[model samples]
Target: MGNYQSGDNTIQGERLSRREAVFDKMDDDSFALFYAGRRKYSSGESLFPFAVNKDFYYLTGIEQEGSSLLLSKRGGECREFLFIDPYEESKRRFYGKKLSIDEAKRLTGIPNVLLSTYLTSRLDRLLRQGLDGEEPVKKGYFDYSPELKIGPELDVKTFVNSLKVVYPDLHDLDARPLVMPLRKCKSDSEVEEIKKAAGYAKEGLLSAYSVLRPGAYLYDLGLFYEHAANSASSCSGLCHLTHIASGEEACYRDPFPGQKQAKEGEIVLLDVGAKSGQYGASICRSVPVSGRYTPHQALIYKIVLNCLRAMENLARPLISLKRINEFALDYLACECLREGLLPSKEAIYSIAYPNMVCELGLDCPEDYGELTLEEGDVIALYPGLYLSGEATAIKLKDVYLVTERGCRRLSDADIEIEDIERRFALQSK
Candidate 1:
């Protein structure tokens, strides 16, 4: 995440440029709808906080819930409209102030701002009768996730996705193609924001050392990291969950790190991130609970650290993450073989499925092998080594920027053996 696209007056211009770029790609008689999704509830009376759609926020720079953006190149006219939840005095007093129409206009530079209630009717009207004596919209674009199951309710679908039911003849298109290229290659500002996020996340991880002694609960460590992350992020909180695991849990994937007690010998693995504006960074660190790595742990750590270094040394602009993956796998395999962990380089693939560095999984489409990365593309390098024989897992996560020179590290969260030993050495004295 480069500097967050906020506060600066120029950000509105950037949002406008993004919307214009989308429009430039669309055919005439085409329209696009981007939604700011509604929040979901976990249980009775409690609900998850609303997060704006990345595509929507990219174009509008608005984070309010239930907001929508409509762009059209219909007939002979090009139009842009922003729809927002109507201002209610009671809701404002209760839940605090949400975005008003004027504020949205000012923020997004979209002149045609309307209430959310008008969206359905307005779109229907546009499709039924052409405005300015022109043809109706024949094609529409929507950001539909591949994970969305084809179900009966169609209840939670975005407003544009529901258009299929109403007008089966409309040519619906995936919005990702038009937006992802722009997103995958971040702007200078976005790079700054991500750098800030990585620094903040590192701060959170370092702060956890305050409570990082033997016998501390993995759950409590997670809590400490979250609190520190939020504080470091200036109260915006986590962009995604923190992964804190120790001992057996560290040896495998456990989505939730629970009450596993730290021992003097085990390693604690933390995959932590924190937000700076809409950007966040992922960084992993594995450290010994005793504050000094044993010979075995150090061996594993160095192996994983070298795997990450491969990415930093090999990644460059115009190369795909797929290519980098191959280089890193080779490095990992050769290292394992040299250490007698494996017999041959080819044998590494057998275990590579669960223990590989795939940064595309974090930000880009699944089929990112062919997509050429440009300068400023940020990616995470998280290499995990699970040694069931030793009952331990070694991992290191870092975020890097693809540059002409190589992959420039945005987050290098080091868990050096010397640093750990020195910290505890002072305590022992």
Candidate 2:
């Protein structure tokens, strides 16, 4: 299977292969249904920019709202169907023409294309036929996640409930278990997209470094980082929130940019990301506003860096996240004891202490809840520190691709303490 390419927009061939793989995994008499997400209202008269459902985009490569995909495996034969919003004059006038049926077919490589308005009738007919046929559909697979709240109009829960009322014998299956594994392991093309995003993130960090001086406001620094990423060719002018913090603010679990001004002899922390081809790269760095780190600050910075390196070394495929966390906790404890920061190993787990390591990902929320340790899953680490009873907080984040052999760092920005000091000194001169 080949990819669909048109101007700046193209879907990789691997996505098509992924869909095929899903089909091959499904039972012979089952069907899967996926929906493109609906646009949400930002305010009274404005709507947030439409973001396609990650799963739907993964399978169909169609990013438009009001779109759906149906894949059926019956009698040892598999077929694909695509449903999309039809051409409407008023909508076209307001938002330009949506993707045409012909273009959708070309983009998605689905042979059957129909207006989304026909979806209800089509599904009803198919389910009825299956009920009357010899090899009826044994299960209906739907994309459902309890964590995500869908609006009334686009609620899959209601649809599934109605389907049960009409066809009580049909079994419903959650598609997440089958699809999440495909998403976790990045393909070559997906890795390239992530690298592009990383490049943009590097540019943003460099831009921030240039203007990182005393009296600089955190908000302006965040804007500078965002502007650099948004201006990059690979970027689609969209990204996650940029976090910029100084001193005590940097030590917080999740810090947001504000009007706080940096002062002399203080370190500034930044956590930013750029999105390209719908993939994102997360990067974090810490810089000294005064162009030099205090001896104490430098020591703490090196500790966090060491922890990051240790985490990188442990990030191999089939390694459990729990193991990684245990390693980090033990490593941090040892370093703390050596540095005289901790009295004993028992104090390592104390929340009041410094040298904490947290997990970071593309979809990780800013206000992440308690970390759960899963034995069968891999982990990503972002290093940061908070010096107890002091006004110092430093954070550094980078994206890593967990490979079969080892982990590969995607965001390879210059984060060395000596390198940062050298750059600042050169700029000062």
Candidate 3:
């Protein structure tokens, strides 16, 4: 969500931010970046209690800006030091409500608290003492995503370099690799939250379908989807922009498009998802605004549906995601030729191969990985069908999980094209 806050906006009582939730679980000696800055609110400027990075929150469950977590196993004592903004009304007026140093410590359940103002001084002392005029320490860690992006604009690189000047023993450790290895797997709670989002996505899809008509604009449909997500909680809108493509624009890869209105009998593909408490689920369903798919539309729809079913049937615990993706491409390719949409199987496979530029605008091998669908795994499968230059297209997307006996669709939406037609016909009547 943009850092904007409006009158209608409410904090919803600070639940543990995802970063904090993650952080509270990390091993001692693991450190993470915490956000410390003013942010734009719809009403005006405000300070985030702190939006800790997801990985960090996954371990700590501490959320407050101007806070740094130093975890160490020294002297037989596990240290959880939290540095926070000192309580000041002037600061509050400028940045909004902030957890005072003590409040920050209490909220985090971490005992030791230090005034944020002393970070530079404390770091200086550590550097001087550790260096002792000997060979410099070689390794240190920090999140560099924001730094890299903002470096040119804010001389962030220079600031980092200056830190090295203070402590010549500096080694940069990238956090992405370390954290991604774990974040890829969801904890029980995390998985449940995702499923909740998936359920909401399905409900939202149905909500959109009911509103489908011949002349509605794409963004209007986007509103219906967002409304469904917000109905759950103060979700962070969407992790990405909504895509609602119609008519000629349906051939475009992603559903995001210019403000085109749906026309008579045009199939509209709505690709949307919601982020509930930061976890996200994406689901897409294509429908005929006129309440019935033409034969061509049905052909495309069935192709995508069969491919999706193939992926679902094969998904199992410990299957490589890369392999599954390959399987999806092969299934789509064979179906394309079998349906007489493409002339030959060899032609379909040739164009579908990696490194081969699909002459027909078909980019096969949609995504990578052979991630075996383990129990509790959540995966998004998007099977799309489009004739290179044709305006007609159909794509179905859903999040599924592999179970012990079979797979279950987490995105509980009405997926059948026939069902959609029936429902739309009833609604129109």
Candidate 4:
């Protein structure tokens, strides 16, 4: 069901199976629509490079503009259709030729491949009248979010409204509910893609670390990290901006690196995110600029590091993300109290002492914290500390694969204090 091809005309493998699984959850008269999105224009025909919609990519494995995937289950029969932009001589000369119908079929395993021109009419026809002996689609799911407020060519809100005005009985629903569950657990191929990104990320981390000197600036490290990451990636220009923060900004995750010079006693951050096959690996490291951490710096670093380790141990299946976050915060508070940094453990949660423990900025604090960890679930963990009085912060982040026993940290970077010091020492020589 996962990795098998059917006939000579179709390659019914990974993406096909993913679509089939989603179809199983859907009602018999429902259709799911996913847009690959278009190459956005910034100013005066200056187009932004296309990034395929994650859900659309997940289902079709096709990355292109003016493309969409439509999956419908009706009358006990599942149908899949892929729409791609038609080839044009001008487009071919400027950018590249669009995906051929045969190529689209081979890549997505969707036997019915159509051009973008036919998409609207095809959808209208399907939603209006019964087709191929199946009842008309009564309900529809879209990769849509009102909060996003984005206007792709097929804007879900606008399209839903227009279609509803014509067919008032058509029911519109969010595709995330049907599709997100399938994406929560990383498939083997997806895991491999993330691991590949992690490999690039580790190299980027070390590359940036190798150049860390007292005179170095955050901008310098960020440039080196981006260079190393993109060089290590399978695709060109795959690595985006490397987020590097210093002092209190470490907890804030500043993406724009500036000429903030390193100080002898200050710590600098190298928050690197690299990608492979659209899967990203996020790794954050805050290190001492002087090679060895100061006594007070090491103290805070140790607290945050210990909290991260404890969180890793607490990442077994069936545990809630919020519970894991709470455990880490509680552990940090206890350690802070032990160090006399906090007057009491309760101070950690005090509104006045908001910076006592750093906020989970990278972790998207409120996003999936309510969900319980499950085997094969891939989640990000950011354990951090912010000592407002000390005017410094420390945070550690890594992606984890939740397993039956415990979680496994995805990045293979050497991030321990001793390792950081040793690498800086060797690089200095």
Please state every model's RMSD to the true fold in angstroms: 4.0, 4.3, 7.9, 3.8
lDDT of 1 by residue, 120-182 (tens): 877886676654545567788877863322222232344454676777667888877887666
State the C-alpha lDDT per candidate.
Answer: 0.73, 0.73, 0.59, 0.73
TM-score of candidate 4 to 2 decimals: 0.90
lDDT tens digits by residue: candidate 2, 230-348: 88834465457788888887777658889899999988888887877776777788889998889988887898789889888877755555566677777777887899877896786
Q: What is the TM-score of each candidate against the true structure?
A: 0.90, 0.88, 0.77, 0.90
lDDT of candidate 4 over 1-429, digit per residue (tens): 123366532324666767878999888888888887776667886867776677787888787877888887777777777888897777788778778898887777677898988888878877888556446777998877543223444466887888899988899988877766677776666677777887898888888887777777788888888888888995534434667867656545454677777777878777677888777777778888888989888988888888888888888888877677678778888998998888888887531222211111112221332567778776667666765456576767787777789988777787788988888888888
- The segments of candidate 4 whose C-alpha lies over 4 angstroms from its true place after superposition are 1-12, 133-135, 146-154, 236-241, 251-255, 349-369
Question: Which ranges in model 2 have alpha carbons more than 4 Å from their true place?
Answer: 1-12, 131-138, 146-152, 233-239, 349-379
Error of 4 at 319 (Å): 0.2
lDDT of 3 by residue, 31-138 (tens): 333333222233444422333345445444444444565443222233445667677788777667867765664455556677877766645544454213432334
- What is the number of residue pairs that collide in model 1? 11
**After aligning candidate 4 to the native by TM-score, how far in Å is the CA of 206 from where it should be?**
1.4
Between candidates 2 and 3, the TM-score winner: 2
lDDT score, candidate 3, position 126: 40
